[model samples]
Target: MIVDESIARPIAASEAHTIEADVAIVGAGLAGSLARAVLVRAGYRVVLIDKRTVPPDEFRVEKIGGRQLDLIRQLGFINDLEAVGAPYNRVLNIRDGKVVDISVGQAFGLSYASLVGMARGLLSDPTSFLIDQVTGISCSDDRQQLELASGKRVTSRLVILATGMASPLAYSLGIKRRMLAERHSVSFGFTIARPDNAPFEFDALTAYGERTADGVDYLSLFPIADGMRANLFMFRDPTDPIMRELRRDTKRTLLRLMPGLQRYLGDFDVVGQVQSWVMDLSVVEGHLQPGVVLIGDAFQTNCPAAGTGVSRLLVDVERLCTDHVPRWLETEGMGADKIAQFYSDQGKLAADRHSLDMARFRQALTLNNDARWSARRKLHFLRRMITHRVDRIHPGWVTRVRGALR
Candidate 1:
């Protein structure tokens, strides 16, 4: 799925006059950028507004695969993704010092900033992007207006709130983030390389905690352009001393948490700054207003360990940009009824519900100590191990049987 490679550059300082468009998306992150690309190519006068033209390096989704990859392909950016990301075909999964299973699939890894850049680069018209902070917004059924920090005005028929988590802009419009779960999960992002700067034994690997009490869900190691990136997801208190130890003596504490890692990974050095994030499971309330719609993290937050963030955002982008937004644009006024159609979209609803459900499921799987859950945890891995053994004995048998059943 390839589209036009040419991109419109960011708005120049002199060209930052009044911005006008059919849709004004506030936030130049993944959601906003992707939406702008789609709308602009569809011949809609779209303006993407954000504070930063160059997104800073941040600890966000560094790798994407499975349904995430499929969604990107559907969005017609698979070729662009291939150009910017490092791809791997196999992931060796281990737990309790033994192989659990081998996941064979396509995946890609890169920095979050690079991913955003790639999205922004999809713009066919450079002037469609405005690198300015939004200070105020006024929405109505017929039209919407925005006041920027630079005293410029942007008027559009519709507004998209994709400012992600912690948006004062959304709060200004009386949209509140209801915390479903606070400090739901803690995650770590960093890079690791062999002492000799060589590649690791595997192209990609994942090691789960031996004991549930350790609070670690898993350590996922994958190849990025820079090096092997490590994303450690855990269900632990952010203030715990173990968190400090992880930041200070990352390699040591990581090995201590998953001793089995050493046998497979040997000795590796953390090559870059250690980044961390504490995620809260939350959803937006009072967002069903005229002329404005919430998307991505602006609509709901996801548990990183669950690995549903990409899927959720992709669904938001795909359903809203490809389906609902176009239909709304063809009509007269952007009202609450029109906006509700997107929130009520079956695919969007399923993605949103699944993201929340997976968040809770992952947390429970990692931290629950109940007798039933403990038994479930054992059976989960046991099933994987058994299936892996069976597959090893007869290659492609699992695929044949599963496909036939389907």
Candidate 2:
């Protein structure tokens, strides 16, 4: 069987679980939990479920975005982030030394220091509050429900399928599920000491100083868990020569990506095992049924390499709860348009805009083109320049932005 981290403990394909809730939420990951929180704050009772009793941060980037850094502070999860985490500030965009784009820590105008690090839990209290962690879900016109493997059932008024790409519950509810075996990729390396420490220990950096023959793919470096950790990623397009040099597994992948770290293996051993996912480009346009809301990963699983996964999901939640739900709930004859609009808007943003941006970034930095590299240099400089101007004109912006800047 293909290895899947869909659960805390892997289960055979035959295993069947059941449950229900007022708002039955599937998946305990970031998107699922955040959506649950929004619904609960709106005064709806939620019964959240996931296949695994104890979900681990297995394949996650474990790094949050500029917007989420703000959300985390408001959600009261900042302490949780501090209890188990690292911070980031600098971003290094490198390409064979000829083209280098470095955004110094907190020195960029638009760049809010983002949050990158491990956390005590999932940092998803909204759904975690209910925390049933069941496997399967079944909803009807009358009410919604979830089914755990042990035969436990919980019911709710509405159902949110935040269950992510791993959910078979998706197919059961008539949501078309597809997978892209390629295009989904990531790698990590560790740095035990600070890069010339000062008053701060947390900063983020990105590097892509190498490129392949076609110039469509390259390798990159970014910080996670503040300056305490670093990740080296090898992105290769189909024809790229770098693909031939990929390490089959995660550990070898790291070493293959960054040979310089060979001496420090023991100092900062891999804290989490190497993990990969299909990085599916699938989208559910309109579910085959009503009363089933596909939120977060269940709806679409974008590339996490860009560090925008969490931010996109938050944008999804904001659009849905703020716009669609109220009208749909009150409508006597609600059609697919009720929910489809929000989902469609998000899907377009993902497939067309975000996806292209990630692809461009993966190509520009990864493939090692001179023009692309120079363009990136100007952009980072422009961004930081704009940020500085805004800061002098508005000191409050920098303070608020700095907290989110990792």
Candidate 3:
């Protein structure tokens, strides 16, 4: 999601040397943009900066949760989004062409939200809410200042690092968090270049725990963003040649890997790129010092396969900028270091929970091929029996339980 805004003309010496504001943001990714939006509305002289402004256009958050969408609408981008999205309702886990498990997704019974396929532009468009973009941040003497790649320096009183996974400014503050490489990464299923604009079925999501002759586990395929496309995601074995093909010739590899997809997306041409969560951010925990705070993935999000990173970040920001920050501003003033510890504590708990859940899910899919497959089936049944209790703790996860019961 990085852009190259370096082509902009050079500025005057006066303007290029020094700049200052009340708040300085480091990155312009999804979380950063949202952080900027909330701050601007709060009347803080905000200076949001990024290394670049290239703007994204391909895969973004496939479909946001209910609360996340509300923020986008508040920021005035939902209207721009409707044109590309198709309502997604159900989650189906199929096996060899038969429906093995039907997940009653959130949309079926409640006022749950829908997910859509989006271009990167929709994900990174919060520049309007900032004082200036295409600027980088650095410290000028004793105070914090922003130095654009173009050599423009802007200073600020309170600096907020919404900078994503790689926070250059936060690193400067001596907060370098580390993450595991996603060799065991999660692969997202997507589709592109379908024949028609017809809506994807409300019952669109499906998972297949199937094994090939070599015993590789992969997810089943279904339509996304209207019936225009469908996809199957399997654990890519580095040893397999298809893994290489899947990256370069995804259209052909998808059809070759699993025959099930051919029936659903055969007529229309399918296009896509394989996305993985290779970045596991565990560093930068101490990035928040007396003057700054690290929110979102910049702090720590999740391991591979857990889809809770974005949601948890949104929740973290909502709690911090909305509730906690104001209280601190009134009572003890700013202790950015304490705030970072507080967020890391809360965020780690959430991340741990998601990591465990994804581990269980991966185990569930893996079990079908193991001798413990029967035990796994019993475990799934037991989970279905106590879904209500689980739902309270996992609003997003309970949907999958319902999918299983149906």
lDDT of 1 at 284: 93
Candidate 2: deviation at residue 370, Å? 11
After the best TM-score superposition of candidate 2, give how far the Cα of residue 230 lies from its true spot, in angstroms: 2.5
State the lDDT at 121 in candidate 1: 96
Best by TM-score: 1
Error of 2 at 101 (Å): 4.0
Model 3, range 1-406, lDDT digits (tens) per residue? Answer: 1112331222223444665555566666666666665655554445556545444443334544464556556556565455545545456555444444456533211101122112224434343233344444454323565656555666655567776676556766678765543444335444555466444443554534444342234543334333433333344444566666666776776555555655554455545445533334354555546657777767764533444655666666666656554454444335555455556566445654675476446534553446576577557645654664566577758668568999
Q: Across residues 1-406, which tens digit of lDDT does each residue of candidate 1 receive?
A: 2222222223334355666678889999988898988877766777898999698788998999999999999999999999999999899999988999999999999999999999999865677887788999999999999999888898888999999998998999999989999999999999998889866789899998788899999999999999999999999999999999999999999999999999998878988799999999999999999999999999999999999998999999999998888788776999999999999999999999999999888888888999999999999999999999999999888999999999
Cα displacement (Å) at residue 259, model 3: 3.6
**Candidate 3 deviates by what RMSD?**
8.5
Task: For candidate 3, give the lDDT.
Answer: 0.51
lDDT of 1 at 372: 95
Q: After superposition, how far is residue 379 of candidate 1 from its true place, in Å?
A: 0.8
Q: lDDT per prediction?
A: 0.90, 0.50, 0.51
